[model samples]
Target: MQSPFDEPGRIFSNKRPLEEDYTPDTILCRDEEIDRYSEALQDVIEGFGPNNVFIYGQTGNGKTVVTRVMMDHLQNETHKHDVDLTILEVNCNKHDSIFNVLLELVNQLRDPDDQVKDQGPTKGYLWNTLYDELDRLGGDVLVVLDEVDMLGHDNDKLLYDFPRARKNGDLENARIGVIGISNNHMFKDELDPRVKSTLCESEIFFSPYDATQLSEILDHYAGLVFKDSVLEDGVIPLCAAKAAQEQGDAREALDLLETAGNIARKENADTVTEDHVERASDRVEEQRVLTIVRDQLTSQMKLALLATTFLNIDESAEPRAKNIYQVYKNICKTCGYEPRSKRRLNDFLDSIRLYGLLERDERNLGRAGGRSYIHTLEVEPELVFEGLEYDSDGDDSVLNQAGIVPSPEDTDQYSLESFGA
Candidate 1:
């Protein structure tokens, strides 16, 4: 229904791609990794025993993306050889419980009947249905549990049952291969030795990308993600270098570049420049740190962080444990809440330190010959106060009086001029 010029120009025209839209098939580099991944699954493709692989890396570095691509290829090739193969990818964080995971598998495999989808069967029923479907399919199934470190103790049942399902008479026709992907390298150590032995049949390590590799990877994406003339020289390299130094996550580098481009467009700039990248990097870093803290913190811990910020802002208080506790008590009183005990508050401080928001240094009280720790907020106290509010029902008056409120002209500024002695 389209014109010839429209079709031809569209086909030949440059399509600017977003960094997140990148795919492995369109991935321009990492040939060596692809080869390694292919060879590792060669045995499984030949209809031999299924392979249980443990894949690990820092955060990104192409671990998940590579596995996704290789698995797709593996399934295709195996199917061509008349091998009945099914691949199921589940993110373990959301499906942490074995029951939840089994439910997910059943939901995926089940027909879209209203009864089946809505009023789902019980765990035992689902497990029976799962085995029944697998036996009916009569082939090899590869189950990729991504973020498998989140499996917690609930994973033991599946880890014990699935692999040994055949000998245990749980399944007759289907063979299951589990490929667990995790950022935590110590996850295997926490597993039962028997489960570890089964899951660790083959292990693949994905190393962090160096600056050069990151730039190369970013370069491939820049062409796809930006207008040809939008990116200035050296911008990609700078973004890549910054991300590589911090986490060596290729996905982060890509996200940085894409974010920079978006920022440029927002500012109505002609091109994506180093300044844009720098601002983008700061924004990304701030978001990343805050996200990490938010996930690790509980409501009480967040309240403690706010209390510390209030102490840092109050002119009469020091940022020490005692002073922070007083401010915490005041904040709780103003918000119509009860402050936890000092010991509990100390525990909260420890939690925030573990969350990387505060730094606590232990030193000896010289004359008294006692040990005490000085606590300092690592980031702007204002951000901490604001972030805590996301999970708190604290009065808005508390924020305003403490000067933790953001200003329209300078949302990024957090002055310590109000720091208490």
Candidate 2:
């Protein structure tokens, strides 16, 4: 009477509910935040101009979720109060530049069959058209720009102009409210004073969750995700501690728990355990680094990292910019790709270093010599090497001929991933 499909284990009752996009039925530990945000949005009901709110916080800090919750409330209350309200939400990351952003707005507000061009009329024309459409609707309209910093320099004009459409005589009716949300802490400081005063009429800051808060959030989702008697008591605490120490990121804590459950489930274990969490952490971090490098970095940057990894695998070596550059040149030559200038290579190294995947230290040789920056892989070399394979030209003979991949007899024993101090 054994079930063939039972070997995957019963650790997960529901997986989707525990995902990052899952919105919980109950939002805990944010009653004060919810109330404050709701109060700010209440202007729609009072016939007054909607308050332009700027929300700033770290990633996974409940900013998006809380905003969605308030938007739901605003939608319902506006309907009940017989007020005309149109809520438009756009993630600035998806539409970074001003032209693209305006195009998105035009598409969203205009007739579906009457789509706009990629680089249609001037952005001012699109803006005026958008204002005309909103005025035709005749109600209070709120535009929420999430990851507002992604707008970069263009955000100045977008922010400075949105709230003042009526005052500036661009619209005959319909008051516009701008809500800009961002994760960049320095974004506000870089903003023009005029933009800061206009867009940041009401500001709300969401602080990172502590261990206790993350623990509660984790336990809540875990209970819904797993069946009874499927997880050890210590599992949640361990995951919570790891995520809290890192950044108090609830999403990370949830991911850790979910990954541990998956690991234990794959092994057909009766319950998730601490050991699974430990292994899951390593895999998650490795995958995070791999995904970042393989997808985000350019070919030259990959070569730079590959060079660093090659030197890193040798214990008796110092990986410097010069060494990395030489290796990068060799790689480019092998792959039939043109090599960039040394200055450009330095720019690539700067980007890699800033990415937090590599650690660099400046050491002064002596009064007779200038300082040199030594580079080391913060990520494990094995992960980097494996990730670099995805960047390979997809031909083994070429790699072997180019001396990029060492033969078995070249070393006593070696693994591309193994590294020394």
Q: For each candidate, give its TM-score against the true structure.
A: 0.69, 0.74
Residue-level error in angstroms, candidate 1, position 209: 0.8
lDDT of 1 by residue, 1-421 (tens): 6643221221112334543434545644557767766776787778885778888767777778888778778888987897778888887756755777787876677566722542546778877888988888778888888877656544577876787777789899998888888776666666788898888788888777889989888887666556667788989889989987876888678778877876777666778899989989888867656654454454455557766765555555557777677766765655556677786677567646644578898877687656777787788654554454443343443445545544434443543333222
Position 334, candidate 2: lDDT: 66
How do the residues 54-152 of candidate 2 rate in per-residue lDDT, one tens digit apiece? 998776788998898788878888889888888888877567667777788778888878987875498778887787788888778899998787665
lDDT of 1: 0.69
Poorest lDDT segment (10 consecutive residues) of candidate 1: 4-13
Best by TM-score: 2
Clashing pairs in 1: 17-224
RMSD of 1: 8.7
